[model samples]
Target: MLRIGVLVSGGGTNLQAIIDAISNGKITNAEIVTVVGSRPGIYALERAKLNNIPSIVISRKAFNSLEEHDTAVCEHMKYCDVDLIVMAGYLSIVGDKLINEFNNKIINIHPSLIPSFCGPGFYGLKVHEAALERGVKITGATVHIVNEVCDGGPILLQKAVEVKPGDTPEVLQKRVMEEAEWEILPKAIDLIANGKI
Candidate 1:
């Protein structure tokens, strides 16, 4: 089975989605071997613990620089024998060291379609806020390989989520997650695990 190492920062709804996919056999060729959280108290840790998956806390404040922090994360992922690093709402910007080590092996599920409400400074509800402010009729999510460039990688999958009227950033964010991110992320993982990506 493929050993997946997930990195998270916040609520970890995306992590839950992947767990569910595995449980339901939507993805059967792999398992979440390890989970890493950037902060201490994030719900992602609880999700990993509940599933009996090994988890680690790599606090950003513990390191002197971003490279130091990513080096630590990279080392841990290596130690875990992670075949694929999945960034499930993981907010930390990975350093070139990790990117170079993983190459196209790392993937991220961004909240919005690439080249639109994505890239640097575009995360969480901020992407939805930009989509709402711009009055875009459609917004969605993207699962792509992680590279040095923010949200700049070969797109693996994408699905459109409609921008409904009177939608708050939070509401749109949830809709996109449920409608697009949740679905395609696991599908992408399955594809990668099956050597279909």
Candidate 2:
């Protein structure tokens, strides 16, 4: 079984999806061992609690430097014996120590197709806004390897949702999020479970 660890920074919609998928046997040979959040007072922790999963809140505010924060987080992961790291809306720019330790064992789901609307400052609703502004007919999600750079990883899977004629960022995002991301994330997790990752 793959011992999975999830990192989140905000409301854990994706995290909930993964948990639901695992419970329903949509993904086999995997279990979430721990859930870590970069900050406190988010729905992610509550979700973990509801599911009876162990969770931790590592405050970056408590650490003076990025290296210190990374050390603290990685230490927790090591303690839990996590085999894989999944970034489910984790906001921090992961530093080198964690990347080096996990390497290709880490996976992240981006809100855009990547190599298009991805970078340090692009995330959440901004990605959808950019895609609509660019007049792209289709914009969706991509699950990829987590590299040192933000969203600059080799693609694993992508699913596109067509941009409707009268779509706003809000509408398009809701559609894509419902039709694409909810399924793609689980598919990515299954790939890892079956030695495809």
How many residue pairs clash per model?
A: 0, 0
- Per-residue alpha-carbon lDDT of model 2 for 59-143, expressed as tens digits? 8888999999998988888899999999998998788889998889889988888787998788988998999899999889999
Per-residue lDDT of 1-197 in model 1, one digit per residue for the tens?
A: 88999999998899999999999999979999999999999998999999999999999899999999989999999999999999999988899999999999999999888889888899998899999999999999999999889999999999999999999999999899999999999999999999898
**CA deviation > 4 Å runs, candidate 2:** none
- Which pairs of residues clash in candidate 1, taking residues 3 or more apart in a chain or in different chains? none
TM-score of each: 0.99, 0.97
On TM-score, the candidate that comes out on top is 1
In order, candidate lDDTs are 0.94, 0.90
Best by lDDT: 1
